[model samples]
Target chain A: MASKKNLVPRRDFIKTSALGLSALSIGLPLNSALATSCGSSGKDKLGIALVGLGNYSKGQLAPSLLETEHCYLSAIVTGTKEKEKEWAKKYNIPKGNIYNYENFDDIASNKDIDIVYIVLPNSMHAEFTIRAAKAGKHVICEKPMAVSVAECKAMIKACDDNNVKLSIGYRLQFDPYHKRIINLSKENTLGSINYVNADFAFTIGDPTQWRLKKDLAGGGALMDVGVYCIQACRYSFGQEPIALRAQAFNSGNEKFKEVNETITWQMEFPDGKISNSTTSYAMSVNSLFVSAQKGKAQLMPSYGYGGIKGFIKDEILEFPKFNQQQAQMDAFALNVKNNTDSIVPGEEGLKDMKVIEAIFKSLEQNGARILI
Target chain B: MASKKNLVPRRDFIKTSALGLSALSIGLPLNSALATSCGSSGKDKLGIALVGLGNYSKGQLAPSLLETEHCYLSAIVTGTKEKEKEWAKKYNIPKGNIYNYENFDDIASNKDIDIVYIVLPNSMHAEFTIRAAKAGKHVICEKPMAVSVAECKAMIKACDDNNVKLSIGYRLQFDPYHKRIINLSKENTLGSINYVNADFAFTIGDPTQWRLKKDLAGGGALMDVGVYCIQACRYSFGQEPIALRAQAFNSGNEKFKEVNETITWQMEFPDGKISNSTTSYAMSVNSLFVSAQKGKAQLMPSYGYGGIKGFIKDEILEFPKFNQQQAQMDAFALNVKNNTDSIVPGEEGLKDMKVIEAIFKSLEQNGARILI
Candidate 1:
């Protein structure tokens, strides 16, 4: 049975989203699914099943799940038995709520788990998200939605056919500083931004890590931290780039034999607004700078999970610090409970993948201008 | 009456520089041109004749001449009679030592002046430097050397033919901060340099100014402040770029109708050490950042007349401030007295002009990579 048993909202969503009738559309007596209070009780808060127990899930997501008002960590799916047992015990999860990857599809019978959060590697995101969608649960897949545009489309289709919601894990969209950046664009405060510069680079360790391999990582730094630069420029300008030129370089390091070590690209938007970005696994630099007609704005150390500070011209932009993961989870949970569309849906991730594909094509042709 | 009447050093210089014999080879009996004393007295210091009294000469160079140990102001040249009279009265210049543009060539008879400093517009650089060479004086042509590579070569040839010393007015070459940057490259403190970023831009004013015209300025910010970004990258890497790609944009501002408002370019050196730069008449940004194998170095507010601060991997680079123009003029004066070649000769300016020509070519081809 689908966790969202009520079918009235699903039918209305289908009509509005223009997804034609599918085999999964079945009628059920509609009841109020919205919660009256946002509390820790199992019935009041949405239950989230984390599909991977990676470092991000262990260090950031699990701790943030404890603090989220609209969501609670109720189950986990891990290949390792030890981690499954460890997480179940730590979070007071029932033995029935824990399952290894082999038995993950049986989650269709678990009515308590309403959402599945896919925190796997770049290539594994599509498989787990599609499996979770087939099991009738809302899916929140981590960034770079999949290895290619085809996989991203398949993931979106599976969620739509299963009558479940799909969202890309874009935590910064909930960040107050990022919201202010969007406001600056909407308000036309800086007056027609002419140039933007964004960079996120760090020296990677462990030559054998999955991120150093193209198969698991898809691309190198461009697929990893480079997406953050792309997101920042888009949010800052509130527009998409039309064409781009990109260059890639490697330092002859054995660690980067299968992937790029550094990549830089210049993008042009409508009306000749331009942006330049650099992402590398060989250096450490993080900044998002914008030059406008009348003033400027900058954020150094911009893409970190926390401690993101910035300035709009002469004014310092300091907001109350909160866990971005928690904010992202709570927002997703509210959308699930209300049967509302997500702001960062699967299409958002697909757009970035398109830009990444164009960047690679430009690199292959010796830094040619590639149209998106 | 070439200023350096002694002929032995000139003949030696010709042999070392590999310049074929020319007509102007007459010489006087050898006498000690080197000064025994360093003081304000007439014979002890090389006398500098200011060729143009623009804002730079009026505000910085003139004051610096007062503090220079080896050079002092003794003559003035201007098209405006009012400025000529004003400068003569302010600096105690005699009527015979002062001349307008029409009478400037007559300075050959005035043995009081040993150096002619060309501080004119971009297009006027070649004319004044060549005339000063014919008038038998060492020439210090301001940065950019001239509007084109051909002009720079002609200036060098004229100075060579007259057997007078020729130096480009690159004041920053005398700065301690710049010296440290060069040392970092030589020492390889940051290991093999991988990436570099430099930018110098400002929102320009006065639409009718010479800087906004194609004829007077040659280009916009590239010819003015963008050269600094190029210089910083060259000094930091100590290697010339082998290839480059460039893009130019204009904001449809009427003032920039004849020139570019902004330009960005990327360059690659022998080992694929890449650099990105931006220059503009539409924004304000100044920085020089380098990312290497071991560490990083940055200088925000990097290129200016004064107050340039920087850091090398967490260590703040603060040194005692001194007048760079004074240091530059004093060093050139010492080169003339000792018959030594200037470190910043016309060849350095010619090299920069060559790179600039390639950048313009790339810009014309829609940011195509051009071999330098």
Candidate 2:
């Protein structure tokens, strides 16, 4: 069981900001004040510790955390003591905050850390997140929440039991440009969304990486990048897909023996609109597009960590240098302190996993239509 | 065989103001100059005829011809006599030029017409185009060239044997913006084409339209709209796709089978880069996008008739409102008189048809990878 003392004090953080003052003037409750402050504040430095120093953690997460105002590097936890020491020295992190995997659970005893961001291999996300929850810390976990839907549910349950806020790192949901597009769609700027075309692919140069290993990364590009397209479809249309059909291809290689390198699928919404989507590790990368009767919304280089732009009706609406990972961390922090539901909560992640599972099932059956 | 004398010289009707001369002097060749100045200009207006008076011809081709320098509306061959009379009166056309389906072949002996534009159903395109060639007249046909590869080849042979130029109306090839995009791509403005994301789709409300009839429209949305994406991909990359994989869905009524409403596909280039592309009738219309290592070139609403805009690395490069259809017609006239190849000739249309055939085959096999 987790203690309340180690968990993020949402009300306290809210009281510490201008948002808290505004909330106080509005006669709102303390939790709502925290929520409003979370949305309003620019960036506040919150000490963050990253667990599982993988490639994404080092390349994307670390750089993004540095750019975030509401978060700063406080500590790191890794199974290898050498890596922990090397990273601590490189980032000039304090020695007291460093920990090996064996003593990772004791991280809750540390007083400086406000959040634990998990960027480990897929299978470890659930275990580490659950342990962090029990240690009375808010947790931000990377996508495909868990290896299985069952694992995701268990992790969510563990967090709830410990009374610690849990958020899945679906960074695009917090992306300002992407969020604006969603708002435009909801406003019927493009009329009704009658169709959607989404794709995410890249040529993977390394085969020995954990992403290619099914046990560690769960699945291939579909799990890694395809989930972004799926979430985009749902958010753009503001609904879950009612039915799905998919097809997959494998080039008969041991590198992708346990996962798929390519997947193409379609989803049918209740409004008779269908979304056509594709994702692959063996192809190129592109932005996802949504077309309605009036106009369209698209994110150029949509899923990348850099150079993301939003367009509507052939005009650019949002061009911001956004750090998706940092924005995600800040949002999670605010949600914890404010007792608010995460924009991309555990339930949303679970639903996306469900859609992913259904897609795999349809592909196995030769693209037979599967009702969601 | 059609005699050159039987063809109306399209240059005699030029109503050139001083503005027109200035426009022509700026390196833009007028279609009328090619007909009169290059060859022996005829004194009489060349009698022109339209075979199919559908939405496209009525809305685009007819209006463009009315503004043409050399072409004249001498005859109309339509299934609906009411529409024929309405069009004849609107254009002040002589009633002797009118003919129905039964009497259409008799116009071969009539001296009034020199050319016929076939704007019929996809399956009927080849039949009418070949018939017009045999009837001693030049032929202008709308795209998807024909329903199949065999049909396109046959149309090409018919026009060749008849000593006439068979032009496929690929209007985008004539649009200055698309041309600039292709030229820039070849010029390496965006570096070597590493990736492409092209899409064309629009919601179709009427399920019983010719587009929904598979036999008439060939496939579904891929035949009607996806052809644009395919052509754009070829032109933007400056090469043919070496391999392709495709997936399609029929979300509409299963019994109303003619065209697929949605399609997702990928094309692999020889340079080890692949394009992720999609087209759907169930969604809104979209433009073509190309991304290279250096930057990206994108056309929002790429296939629309007007208000087309192109972008390079977020800077607006071209915004043109000239009629794409009229530009195509003028170019075809120039090619005919100057003995030059068309920007979008029979060969290009044939290549696109070949790719379309492969996409259909791959879809039937559950998105099996096919080498183009």
The weakest ten consecutive residues by lDDT in model 2 chain B span B11-20
Tell me, by TM-score, which candidate is best: 1
Off by over 4 Å in 1: A1-42, A100-102, A157-163, A176-180, A187-189, A307-310, A316-322, A338-343, B1-42, B252-254, B317-322, B338-341
Complex DockQ, candidate 2: 0.22
Displacement of the residue A271 alpha carbon in candidate 1, Å: 3.0
lDDT of 2 by residue, B13-99 (tens): 232233246437755455443332222134234556888899998898888877765566678889996897799888777777887
lDDT of 1 at A281: 90
